[model samples]
Target chain A: MSTPTETETPSETETEGGTRLSYETRDRLYHLALYGSAALFSAVILFPIYWMVQNAFTDSQTVITEFSWLPSPETVTLDNFSVLAAGAVPRYVINTIVVTAGTIVVVVGVSLVAGYGMARFRFRYKESFAQFLLLGYMFSPIVLGLPLYLIWSEIGLLNAQIGLVIALSSISMPFAVWLMWKYIQTIPESMEESAWIAGASRWRTFWDVVVPQTKPAIVACALFAFAIAWNDFTFAQILLPSQESTTFAPGIMRLIDQGGYTSWGDIMAVSLLMTVPPLLFAYFLQEYLLKGFEVRTR
Target chain B: MTVHIDNMTRVFDSPNADRIVAVDELSLTIEDGEFLTLVGPSGCGKTTTLRCVAGLDTPTAGTIRVDDRDVTELPPQQRDVALLFQDIALYPHMSVRKNMEYGLKIAGVPEDERREHVAEAAALLQIGDQLDKMPASLSGGQQQRVALGRSLVRDPSVFLFDEPMSDLDAKLKRELRPVVQRITDEIGCPVLYVTHDQEEAMTMSDRIAIMDDGELQQAGSPKEVYSEPINDFVGEFIGQPAMEFFDAHVESANGTAAVSMGDHTVSLPATADELEGYVDSPVRVGVRPQQIGIGDPAEGIEAEHVLDEPLGDETHSIFETEFGDVTVVTHADFDGDGDTEYGLVLDESATQLFDPDSGVRIH
Candidate 1:
């Protein structure tokens, strides 16, 4: 049976003004455009991810020799994942996790204190200082990497995970502070004053009142610092030349650049594994991230 | 404990403009269990004074003493005072119970004691069932109760409310005013409440302190301030519908003073020696709307009927006369029709005379 057309159905809810398009038809057209663009953009962005997943499940020989839209069920194997377990991939991942966690801790600590001060305190050149913070954020990591490398070498922190953590934190610190400062501004001063009048010292009030209200901003800052430290390659490669200190991003590059036949299957498998932490973070904390950027007054 | 504010002053230094004096050498005292309301127009420094008492804002020049102990140099947390903000300032992330428990916890009260105090406060505020609910989940009145509960649990030496009921609806304000008064009575502390609403001041305060231009105009019981305002500003400000002023010529005969506005004249007692200086000169006469009698043209000064506004139980009749618009409050049943002439009768006992230039009361 055929569905009814616009001409045949003749919508009773047609709007009175401007145009003859029925409300339902207009709504449907708007949603179609919206969801169509979303789906197309998602596909464009996700195609490489789809390919990586396909390569990750296939045997190394099959991934190097064959190109297929869909893998044959019989040829699909868990051997590529087994190759990862038998190699240094897990160690590199652990290193990446360590750097990301350290970056988060440092970034969150500095940003909370600095941001709260910026939001609440009054002092000379405070506005100028806040603007200067974003200036550091504007510089590319490549521009900072060499100077940071020189600094780390001079400080005897080179070829170490601690060096990478400090470097990553510096890169993300400005943006995290700016985010937190603006977010904290939305919280009313009365809340803090109320706490103070309730017999809480300034420090106690900051921890009890300001910190809890800043959960969304804290989560967003952590995710941002995580992404910087986890996906970072230029700083990691330049700072940590030793094999033992290398993280996932540079370690994956080393696996591909062995000067022989490249392991496409192994690269895709490790790359797929490398994407998991950030994916999981974004999946769970997307609500707070949205709230962090929301224009709210509370 | 009694709270004494001695010459409290606050000057705000602005970068781009002239320095502003927010509160100028204001002094007042609140005896224990007394609810004193600082009422004034906007920018009259009531909120600034309250903040100074709470130690949130330091007075540029003053001493604030609670129970004869000077607290002017103390930090807000060190000063034993509880302030309820106009926004109600409840911690949004905390549950009602935790909010009430916050101050107690900060004071290092035992957890069991904190729980007991919170329960007692919640019971007093009628919010026992709301202990587990977040502030956002509660109604406006309930949220106000939670805020009050938070303060109640602290049991501070002084309670400060900065227009706490201003955020509530009219009905809620009427409902909460008595509850707040009762709470303050139960706490038996010196409460400093700040508001610009004169009705709230009159209905809620044991003594209403009226302020203008960062200076105290008058401080008295509502009835005294209403009937015996010390100046034209206080006379005009303290009453609802406000006292109206008219320029009148004074005439003294047989040691008694008679003042005439338009064609109406009212005789005053000989005891008002201040009126002798203004003989045949213009004096400002301020009279409340309820005190001005309205009747037929034969009774007194003739005025053209302008409008009659019904205010629930009373009608405010506006009349255009030789001395500007005069409003008279009468029974709700009295409604003036268009184009009718009415006479305004002013009794000397009900009218206040002031110097036209200084606005200081002449009698």
Candidate 2:
């Protein structure tokens, strides 16, 4: 299927005129090139993921001795997963879920109202305020971490899941607000005016009308906030140094840094476990992500 | 239900430009059950005035009173008015039933009563079967009906239509204009419609208020504004083919008034006797195209025929007269050859005389 047949090159005159090649041969070649490149890119991207899964299934003894690309069925074992289920991995997973969920709730709530105000209301220094928000988004978390830690410690929130949640929300808030403001601006002002003329108060209009209309953007913002808080290692490591309070990302790093080469399978198994929730969440919410990009009125 | 706008003004200040006075000291009264239309060219402050009435745009000064209650300081939700936007601003996410019932729900009407009101309004609009459908699924005309239904269910004290029919096709617009009129009539509420289309203003409004540069030009019935315009702008802004103006000198001799232009002089009617004091002064004579009559070549002022535009029922003959270019709308059966000369007579009763400098009507 990769090589062109003899009949495929029968269109020299058509090619010279800049017209299309013969239908059957052209279709075959075009599809072959498109699908071949697609498969190649998929393999390139998915190979690391496949390797992680293979390492997670292999026994610790086999992983230490063999360097084969494929895992043999006889050597595949559930010992690494059993160790993870029985260890602190469960507690770390719960901590990650709590921090990520809290971060998403706070980020989505505050940013939605702030974004709506920025997009709809006319205020003094509006442009300057928006620029200030963009600056917050542009600044790296590393730059803001020391001050945040000091403030959390002063407030007696250090080493607490709520403290981690608040820190993650602050990092994700500006991006969430920027996304929401851009989305809400696409809604015509007439829709709000219509609600107003329908006898709805401002609060009712915001909740009943603007909220429902911006559902897709809200879902996308939630997913983004989730990803930010779920994958954060730096903030969790700095703010939560206690062994029992840390999230999965820093916990996995701590396990890998224990200086033992025979525990590779356990590390791979935990990493694979950490990737599952986000993949499932994104897969289920792919529809809303697509809809978020469509900002037309009707 | 009377809407009294007292010396209302709206000024908008842009970041990059000076303040724009959108509605300047505009005052009007819409009586109960009367349909008044604000008509003008684009950027003429008609929509601004309508928005002010709807409480969508706040006025810089003055007060708006509906049924003797001053609502200028109130928000749109507090004012008992329904505004049908130009885009037919239906809540796209809601079903038709939900859209119509929203206002009632917000007003704290009982559920059963809300359902009844929605049903009644939907039936009135003939959209009962489409209640469950979303606005995106409906056609343009259907969407317009749904918008009207939403407003109708509110039973507002006033209805503000912001060119709601402008988005529909010509046939649909024609079909829906009377439906709008009938609904407003049934509701017996004052309606203030805004549109830049003169024809819609003339056909749909009980009284038309013409505006230009954020100032009211004139407010009168369509016939009064068309036949006896207060100024040159009103004269030119109304009617098809437009009114034509000729720069002429007013001459009063032998106890009679006449206007002289170039080599021709046409006698003015007795109603123009007010111009006697201004005899021999330059004045602008206005005449509608339909008011000009073609006569025998030997009888009246001579004009050379330039072209003929044959409409279905009448043919408008463009002639090169001493008045520059004049259009005469004659019956369809009337025949005249292009390039030939003919005599023209102005309908003395329809002739409008204006001060040449100020463009204000003399009588």
Candidate 3:
């Protein structure tokens, strides 16, 4: 809502000295550059999702024959969404929900406590242990999946939904704990000490004071764990081979393999559906998630 | 209600450095209803001593007793002491009322009783209307009142304030000082307040315990410490403009004693008997700014005027003398732009002598 001011006349200001700019002019130019890059980056990132939505609503014949920026309304139909009502797609979604919920519960609870201890307490090898957590997080999931498959097969945990849940949690938990630890560090320690002096035991103080202050971090950690478990393909593919335990990420591929044919419309529809929960999570909880990442000092 | 800190010591050790003795072997006692301000410079261990009494920091060697019971090893909750932090540590998520009720709730006080305690404390602190508001919704002073109300509800046997008003502005500090004093007086508990401001110690405390370098320098009433300081550190630390000192030599001959500085000398009074030991030896002569006066140019010790600081009711005039710079406080106005030379009249009877080597009072 800014009107054009004297600084908006770049030529007049630049005439004084070609390299020297007025403060307002310089600030406007910087913002224009920043927003230009952001728009370009967002377009690049969002194009695939936009194309998937476009193709999902179009008939498979038209989608295959035409390359268009916008879908024609005449070809749009609800027939592509029939995958949601039938086949392994529904079962895959149910399995994903159970695994995602379990991962969230395990990750949020454990990381909350571990993060509190890491931020507040001092013990032997504390720094080393913290570094070790980051080190564990750096390994690719494929590196863990192969070794973990051998162990799961030995224990008969293979092809179980619980095995997938456990695998996903281990993959996501280290970074979640690191996020929580850094977030909790921003909270003042005196807030906890005040509770301790108020006759609350250490556990009671942690619950009454620290937990309430960490709500944003809790939400953010839950979302993080959910995204990891929901979108995970490697661990789910390796551990849960049965269709009953297979989640959407790898289960949708089974359709192409079933009859030596690819239903591009059905595939696009399923891919769009797969992106919903995470998109909803990002849209609804973006405030708390942003706050969780902000390292505000008090 | 009395708190006894006996030979308490706290030592911190780390791998990269030598051990830090935060609080040396120090002993002190706070009688019931006494408002004792632990006043000192930074890194002087005043806060450490207060923390030990509150059971926040464990003393490495000595025992602390509260109300005739040894509470040295007890945690802060079991010690029955309420501490007001300088940071005003209020629970940000809770309303003022909930903040006050937290201690009682943890102690298993029933809902009705907890509400009553919270209500009473809220009314007492004039924060009754703010009970339902979050701490962030209130002003800084109001937030601090909520913090005070939180401690007031507990009614602990000992009250500890760690520079509570240090964050407030000058006007706010002056307003809150009497409020804190009146509340502590009504509670009749041993209150140990810590601050580095000497003026705060003088105005608010019934007695002051001055500390330096992890050791107790002196502990007495403000009047007593200001007038009869045991050492040069206390003399220099207690006053606003600070007491000035000059190098002088004691000259004792035939039952009379006098101290000479540069070319001027002042005869000692009946207390000259103490100067016999310091005869023909160097000493530090300490005098308050108020004790010296601007004299005639040819009468007293010759000096050159440096600057004049007008402090409302009085002016502090700094002058360069043969020994060093001396400050003379007077009620008369002096122009800083004029008058570069003057003589300083030393008040003979008011001057105190100290050993130059140890900075300890000689008489």
Candidate 4:
């Protein structure tokens, strides 16, 4: 209940009368240690990203050398990217973009209406429906892979873009619901009520007042979905493996498989290629991204 | 311009479809251009009544008429009303121009008129420069003006203000009140302002309608309500220092009418001739803090000073008198103790008396 003396009036209490030399030494030591560890940790975290780009330019000749962290003159080249691009891989990038875009549309659009319903309206099984949607998040997707493959195969949706869309979207919906619910809760109920009284229809209030205020959250939700759908390898590998339907993830894995493990340049290049879409989306939406996480309260 | 509500009621039925009446079967008429405030404590149905009139929520059983036309089943837009909410719900993503432009667009105003109106409201509110800025970029007061501008573009006939100034600091509230007064005056429409803060109601409304426990307790002009409250609730709800209430009895001291408390007699003005026969009945006396001046300790009825609040201009001194602990506002300051001997003299014109049991104010 009581604030500490140091926090109450720090200048007066930080060091009564004078700073101890030993304490200053300890403090400087702590600062050095913190920045040092942070720098080391940042390098460790970004190493894979750095290695991906590094490996992309390096050819198969030197990738398996003890030089994972460096580029060797004998093995560094653009041949892997050229080889990948020469085939149907570029087409697969288009397919991946199509599938991810499709998934984002369904995920964002459905979650928005569903989130608003679960947040503001009254209906039968409202709570239970929300729970039912959330139930999709309970288990690992690997467990359902077999059944999903069989279902899609039986439905004749296997090896199609729509199959990838449905697969990735179903995986992303529960998360979308949960985040959207939390985001919508932050907008005070009075805000929508005000719109109601301000002569906006129920639907108008959603579009005019609620949706505008929620843009930051919605964009952040899109970013989350984009990340999930883009990086997804399992469903794309399992559901769409036909010649024309292969996505970026499955295409990259197949390239690495055929080109042997030493083609570090190809592997790393594809990894870095996948990172650019999210990195670009996040870079452009940096402001909303910050705002989305900032909890709003009335 | 006129508002008529008959048998209005709203029941909250979620937890148990067993109804909890927020606004009970209430009915009233508001004259054209009347700045009537629905004032009460929280959960007192004041806001609910305003919401019903605004068509934000449908009443369980009732009809609402605005300007002689039924709007009970109509939604807010169809009812021709605009509400300035407590949160000032301006869209954060849009510039102030777009924010105000939305209502006009919805109302089917032409682009030229919408632009002209947005500019006019912005300039009228002195927020012309903020038109290009998003709502998040403006200060709270400016954002509120944008909300007002949005409503102004709609040009609705009825203005509903739901505690619009409740979120601002005291200083900003004081600054914004006169601006609101100017805008409402220029528009001259029927206005329903809802607030639990009686000070705002007293300052902003032409008539203050006091709501309590899902019922209308009393309604009158601010001055009339202050001078002649219908009950203890109205008296207590209105006034700055609030009316001091005391449980006493009407008595005739040998042919002279007076109220006696523990050997002390308040010889009320003889104009109160109606209480001539009500001699032995217990009564409640209400007096405003402003009406009583603390005189010389030896000249008037004695009391003790309990506490004093200096509100810059006038000092509110609470004194424990024989009748009750009374509030007195004065410019002078003095240190006093328990039974420190303070005299009291009432401006009988401003004091009210009520029935002790029923709390009905008696003239």
- DockQ for each model: 0.70, 0.68, 0.65, 0.44
Worst 10 residues of 1 chain A by lDDT: A1-10
Stretches off by above 4 angstroms in model 3 are: A1-43, A60-69, A290-298, B253-256, B337-339
Winning model by TM-score: 1
**Candidate 3 at B181: error in angstroms?**
0.6
Q: What is the TM-score of chain A alone in each candidate?
A: 0.86, 0.86, 0.85, 0.81
What lDDT is reached at residue A286 by model 2? 82
In model 2 chain A, where is the ten-residue run with the lowest total lDDT?
A: A1-10
Compute the interface RMSD for candidate 1. 1.4
Ranking by TM-score: 1, 3, 2, 4
Q: What does candidate 4's lDDT look like per residue over B303-355, in tens digits?
A: 78898788777788888767667788877554455655778777656667788
Task: Please give, for residues A76-118, the per-residue lDDT of candidate 1 as tens digits.
Answer: 8877886567667877888888888999999999999999999
lDDT of each: 0.87, 0.87, 0.86, 0.79
Measured with DockQ on alpha carbons, how good is candidate 4? 0.44
Select the stronger candidate by TM-score from 1 and 4.
1
Model 3: fnat (fraction of native contacts)? 0.70
Q: What's the number of clashes in each of the models?
A: 0, 0, 0, 2
Top candidate (lDDT)? 1
Please give the TM-score that candidate 2 achieves against the real structure.
Answer: 0.91
Model 3 chain A: which ten-residue window has the lowest total lDDT? A289-298
- TM-scores for candidates 1 onward, in order: 0.93, 0.91, 0.92, 0.88
lDDT per residue (tens digit) for residues B173-281 in model 1: 9999988988888888999999988999999889999999899999999999888888999898888788989888887644678877767777876454556678888
